[model samples]
Target: MQEDVLIEKIKKGHKQALRLVIEKYKHTVYQVVFGVLRDEKEAEDVAQETFIKMVDALPSYQQKGFKTWLSRIAFRTALDAKRKKQRQREALTEYAPSKEASKSAEDEWLQEEKSRAVTASIAKMPETYKGVVYAYYIEGKSYAAIASEHRLEEKTIEMRLYRARKWMKQHWKEDDF
Candidate 1:
């Protein structure tokens, strides 16, 4: 079967073929973004972006190493999104916090504060280490899948996750969790 056949069908808006393509590439795209963003929700967002780009560019997609090309696009898009988010966060952090806040022993407020603190700690972690933790724990991605997506050995992914968890434990108390 010619590659263009699938491409043409997809470009012409054939839902079945489009769905097939999505199924084929969805995990790959999700793994790529998850390896970078270290957040399941953010990875899902980037995966959607990847699919959108694939659909929009389908008509002009070249036949050379299609999967690699798709992977490259997914990788770049995720990194760009991460950089943009980091910049926005830094800008927001520049704002001074209010000094006088009401005391709150309420469960909702305590929970919210704890969530914020955990998020902050995760954000502080080095990107590579954080990626492993998010992929394994939060995304519930397997070590083997992560290793394959990243072209690394499974042991490496395991070690990264192990160290990341240790770092989190050392830096954050159980109460913070």
Candidate 2:
């Protein structure tokens, strides 16, 4: 059948025209989707989806080039599927720790408890030393940065950290962790 005749039949809601369109374009659509997705099952699925979309969108389609328009639908559908899969993979990786991390539920709990104890110990320190210890250790700031922020000499920041460590050692027990 001619392309223009097929399109007119399709526009008039002829089932035979729809079936003929599918038969003519299925392989091209599958290949286009497969080129982007690289997975046979997903490519097939996207190709099917493209045809369904074509049926819905046929009324609005300008008769430019039927093959070109159909191929564009297939390409866009495949790209959308690829992007959705990538986003799902990223979401899984963001929260899932690597096997090399070797952290158990018990280990996580113990680590949280130790952190709380350390925080309590730091809170008990004198006001001047507390800021220095927090900046250098918890906040991971350099001595120079801490000094600049606090309007003090770098040497003063170092001395305060030293004093804080000594205070922690004397006041906090090993069991506290």
How many clashes show up in model 2?
A: 0
Model 2, residue 57: what's the lDDT?
A: 84
Error of model 2, residue 137, in angstroms: 34
Residue-by-residue lDDT tens digits, candidate 2, 1-177: 998899899889899998999999999999999999999999989999999989888888898999999999899989999999999999999989887588888988988898888888888889989898988888999999999999999999988988888888888789877
Model 1, 1-177: lDDT tens digits are 344677678888888877777787889989998999999999999989988888887767778877887888899889999999999998887774643344456866877877677667787898888777767765789999989988999999988988888888787788766
TM per candidate comes to 0.52, 0.55
Q: Local distance difference test, per candidate?
A: 0.82, 0.91
Question: Which residues of candidate 1, in runs, are more than 4 Å off?
Answer: 1-3, 97-177
What 10-residue stretch in candidate 1 is worst by lDDT?
96-105
lDDT of 1 at 122: 80
